[model samples]
Target: MAKAFASQGDTSEKNISFTEIGAGIWAFTAEGDPNSGVIIGDDSVMIIEAQATPRLANKVIEKVREITDKPISHVALTHYHAVRVLGASAFGADQILMSDSARAMVVERGQEDWDSEFQRFPRLFEGHESIPGLTWPTTTFSRSMTVYLGQRRVELMHLGRAHTAGDIVIQVPDQNVMFTGDIVEYHSACYCGDGHFRDWGQTLDAIRAFEVDAIAPGRGDALIGPEMVNKAIESTRDFVRSTYQPAAKVAAKGGSLKDAWNEVRAVCDPKFSDFAIYEHCLPFNVARAYDEARGIDTPRIWTAQRDLAMWEALQN
Candidate 1:
């Protein structure tokens, strides 16, 4: 291979930050790693997007402990990705919630994703053995659902497909803060292995319509104030468009996947080369963009073998 496969070369630990974006809403971020949201309600707390394993989830729990002692009532998974959902067991919340589509994806390719992700980035899965099995939601809603944590109202809604088919955003009406799983990233690359490039922008539009005050995004730093929030949304939109446009054009002209990849790199590198996980996510993003442009609506399941095959092919 030309370089390390995915993030295998990334072994150094990142400094973790727990920032309060709203009155009781916290964003747990680690450099550019996957993030988790903490919503402290009047009586209890609700967590959004569990980390990859129990060991990592404990980091978020430790931060949550610094604020309040309210028992975690619910763990809301924004999507069905292994890096996000596999850590649900660590929370032990009374209710593990997910969108109906997310639950179905769990049934469809949960194990495959776990295996693929673990192999791609071992640093995120520090304590892989601790993850009992595929995490399943205790409850699921089709479109949207409102959960009142005491007096706090948290709304989970599937605005549209972006990061994944089941991606959902958590909105706090009172504070006007939203926890957008992987739909909106701040100075970080969007991992689009299973993303819907066509629908991603529309999803961002739906979130924009809310005009929220702050957002605890899927990765990078927490966005506070409208300036930072809008910046992240538009940058994310640019990242997605920059990645897809070149690849789509290549596919439109009956170019090979390698040709599409080179074109995508030519366009995306100048703008997003410094983004977190840019190199790790590029190949998969290009492959999916090519597929989507070629009329593949649903993303194919990525297994460990497929990940290696794709990486090797792209390396050449």
Candidate 2:
């Protein structure tokens, strides 16, 4: 079960669960909550993603301690989202790894994003001051990097651009499990503020090409079996299409952004009524999808003021 809380105010769920996806992989997920994954090896451990702050990371560390006594050796950041990468120091890993693009995003807007996200989501950053600094990747790879935790081999690869320019997936070949950052959310809404919709579908295809039986997405429930695995993929696809087509039609027809949002809200709200963070994601998704459909090359960086402006414009 996933326990959820939507920031500090409004609605939230509790009792999040960490499901063991494979022999050494465990996923801590809450409905509408940010996710963190742990991979324990024979003598050491590698955490897939870190929570937003040390306060939250401690809770995850406590969970991992209950399962293994091995020290956390590496922290692999899937992308550079503040909620996902800001708390790198909490794990106290030997190394933190990420793709080149993620590092670039961090350098470009790390401070802005930190301020922006903290304002948007307060509960996730319970102890904001504990953060050491911007979570820069100690080790960075252009496309792929492979690490051997003792004898276990874990391959980290950047499939393509979908969620963000630097998105990566953690693949455990032996375990047949892939920890997909925000590329393949299961039962969780795609926060497409900086996403590539058409390209995102192709990225999902790239992920499916891998022979994965289990997966831990950026948020929401873990995909335990093959059936749920397929369901998550298909559901993500549906969510993408449902979010895009409406926006595309409006954009292509010269309709306003507000019109596109209305179209997306009308179509998606009913289908994804139960998805996590559906409301929070709607405004951002519509904004990006509308831009992509109109041929905007890169997503406009989301700022604190812009987020409020967009929310106020669409939510009413």
Candidate 3:
């Protein structure tokens, strides 16, 4: 291969930041790596989007400890992606929550995703050995579920599919701060290998309708006011559209996947080449965009072998 596969070459650690986006809402971000959210409620704390490993999750726990001693009673996983859910055990939360569709995806492709991501980004899985196994949710809701962390009312809703079919967002009504898991990103590239390009904008619209005051996005910096929040949402929308439009046009004209890839690059690179994880996510994003444009509704499960094979094909 001409280049390292995915983020395998990115071995350097990133500076971590634990920023408070709202009164009790915190965003634990590591440069452009996956982000985790902490919502300290009246009596307990709720975590959103566990990191890739127990070692990483401990980093978030350390920051949470700096603020309050409230026991973390619940963990809400927005989706079933290995990078986001595998580190859940570190929280020791009594209740692990997820959308019903997310749990189903875990049953279908959880192990495969773990293997695939572990190979793709070795740096993120710093302590893979410590991970017991796939993280399973103790409870799941079909559409929307409300959880009360003492007096704090947290709403988990499936706005629509964007980053993945089972993506859900956590909203704090009192604070008007939403924790959007991969559904919304600031400056980071959206990993769309398992995404729904068509429904992504609609999902963003749903989140926008709320006019939330703050947002703890899946990656990049925590968006603090209405202006920054709107900017991130629109930029994310542009990224998704720019990626899919060129590829969709190529597919419409019966072009090969390689052709679609070049077309997508032609459109996306100039605008988003500087975004975090741009190169790492490009090949997978292009492949999925091509598939979706060709009428494939569901994303194909990505195994370790498939990841390499796809990367090699794109390289050639």
Each model's Cα RMSD: 0.8, 3.5, 0.8
**lDDT string, candidate 1, 63-168, tens digits:** 9999999999899999999999888899989999999999999999999999999988999999888999999899999999999998899999999999999999
TM-score of each: 0.99, 0.95, 0.99
True-structure lDDT of candidate 1: 0.93
Runs in model 1 with CA error above 4 Å? none
After superposition, candidate 2 runs with Cα above 4 Å error: 1-8, 11-13
lDDT of 2 by residue, 75-100 (tens): 99999999998788988898999999
Report the poorest 10 consecutive residues by lDDT, candidate 3: 1-10
Candidate 1, after superposition: displacement of residue 76 in Å? 0.5
Backbone clash total, candidate 2: 3
Q: What is the lDDT of residue 176 in candidate 3?
A: 94
- Compared with the true structure, all predictions reach lDDT values of 0.93, 0.87, 0.94
Judging by lDDT, tell me the better candidate of 2 and 3. 3
What TM-score does prediction 2 earn? Answer: 0.95
